[model samples]
Target: MAGGMRNLDPVIAVDGCAVGGEFQGKARPEGKTWLEGKRWEAGALRFCANLSRCSGGRRLSSATNALAATSRNFRQATRLLGLDSKLEKSLLIPFREIKVECTIPKDDGTLASFVGFRVQHDNSRGPMKGGIRYHPEVDPDEVNALAQLMTWKTAVAAVPYGGAKGGIGCSPAPDMGTNSQTMAWILDEYSKFHGHSPAVVTGKPIDLGGSLGRDAATGRGVMYATEALLAEHGKSISGSTFVIQGFGNVGSWAAQLIHEKVAR
Candidate 1:
């Protein structure tokens, strides 16, 4: 809501979230956003980089109050880096925030409508990159925070991409969410506006240009980050006890990767 997200309506499916710089009504064409007022948790960047590992109980902090302790830290980081005011403001703004309404027919011949959002943060380094989240209780603010987090993360990590977050508020899915099929649908839907923009999305089936090792990409990243962080603390991943939250692709791979390291 802080980023003129009110201006984005849930009427059209989405003419926003342009890939490769090709959308007509680009939000704030000047590449400025009003998201500095939004707050992010200290570890929110880490939380967002990985796929949805901690699912169902833990939220990404829906409250904007202090944005959960990273507000001042964010500014302090900028100050520490001796960033100029204009650049600082630019860093704080998101590129675009989009909301759309999507409806599909259920197997029972009933129509199901769901609300979807895509918040695209800065892309100075490269294309905006993020993940899709599906949950009945998906929080738009959380997604916004995630988008903001992605910008900070990719920038800091030099990942050569910006941040963007998308989610659809929908029901449980053994049939709907959490698989390559879902990405296929998303690719098709997004392609309706932008022709053959496969790169607009990731995690699709390999036949559809999906990359190898993507399933383990998030988990592998978590492993590497943990190793780096622990190295600074004079600790190692060996003999560590871990408690996983969600056993999704990310969580499962994280567990496996960490275990492999620990065993080694």
Candidate 2:
């Protein structure tokens, strides 16, 4: 023998790789590989072992590493492309942030307080345009991020629109009948500052002077795009199986259009 076998604890090896601290009595040797007998830190090996367990041993470790590498590559690419720090800082600024508190009477005849936020990110091109989402998670940071995205999206689309996003943080699921009332309250509150400029925001109810076709514009656009693509491929919208994922205005309209085509 080259050297006497040092009496030490048996290590726990997973997939021919030593995972962590040694396995003691009652631990049997499973198998062996050339990679064995290599020293590894207990913490690092434990982390790797936990990752393997979490991933169900389906080689997700490689995917995790790939994502890390991809992030590094993205950083390098940004540097290579000469990303403008000044432009990034300027774009990060929010044009305005509005916070309001309102009192609404509950079913119990008690007044409840609600806080709402509206963040206008930019208005370089024209009037600001965006949606007013109603969710409990609505916050200034989220509104700001979405408004910034809208600004960039409008710029990319070459639309004569700036960006604005607003919302009232409240639960919309509790009372379906009260949704319109809530929206009305939100509209009223918003109008105090923005005025009754229907064009400033889309998706307002018809009574609020919102554009007639604006509600289904996105769905109509999607349908048109799909029809053009199918026509190019010698296919028609009729007699086609359609699956819609969302139940929102756009998805609902798209489904209705497709269903009518299929019915005919």
Candidate 3:
């Protein structure tokens, strides 16, 4: 098996081991066969079982993994900063966790319900700011991770707002019975607690006081960031060519801004 694997592509051998553990079954070097006689299905099952065990005996969800990674990074960062242990613990914890059931009347005169979550991770620097994503995979753990990310990101960028994230386990598609209406619902419910505050949320419809530039804020920020870096090196945005991904909110705006700079 060892001799046969040596003949196989190194990448494939490494991938096989990563997925099925180290090869134990012998292979025929004459045929250049690797793991040919091994019960791959059984090995894969055993690998999954071990993976579950490592993740607290439950199937690892994306949200759980995301939160774990964020927490790990936060710990490492705090250690390097020589932060106070108590403060570090406090910073790692969320300020609030809100879960609500949103029931809306369907077009057919029936009621449909969905679960929503809002996790305010921290407010040490300023008011919390984040987006409310509407997706079926939205969960508390993922929202918490995003919120924590916002906290750190704002601080790093010197933004006056803190970090937060909210979402509902509902489709964002209109055909799926949810759309901007979902965001409106979230805003109303949140305002019931925080009062009528447009600043409390973003990515809202312009009619609801969402800035016309809201969708472009992220892209504009990226452009400005690039400009700053280039300026420090005695370069400028007008002299640069950029490759941006996605035609969506941030990417589109960044491209527009960069194009304008280049054209000028």
User: Best by TM-score, which number?
Assistant: 1
lDDT of 3 at 33: 30
Off by over 4 Å in 2: 1-83, 174-200, 204-208, 221-240, 259-264
Residue 117 in model 3: shift from native, Å?
A: 0.9
Q: State how far residue 111 of model 3 sits from its true place (Å).
A: 3.6
Instruction: Please name the candidate that would achieve the greatest lDDT relative to the true structure.
Output: 3
In model 1, what are the clashing residue pairs, if there are any? none
lDDT string for model 2 (222-241, tens) is: 56655655565456677654
lDDT per model vs. reference: 0.58, 0.52, 0.59
Give the 10-residue window scoring lowest on summed lDDT in candidate 1. 4-13
lDDT for predicted candidate 2 compared with the true structure: 0.52
Give the alpha carbon lDDT tens digit for every residue of 1-264 in model 1: 111111111110011211111112223455332122232221221222222232211222435332233345578888898989888877666788889998899999999999988888778888888776677876666577677777887888887888887777876655432556667787898789879878877778899988788778767876776666655545567865455444566656877998898733
lDDT of 1: 0.58
Error of 1 at 135 (Å): 2.8
Model 1 spans > 4 angstroms off? 1-72, 173-177
Clashes of 2: 1
Cα lDDT of model 3 by residue, 124-239, tens digit? 88888776666777778877987888889889989887888777787755443222344556578778998986655455677886556655665677667666655654567675
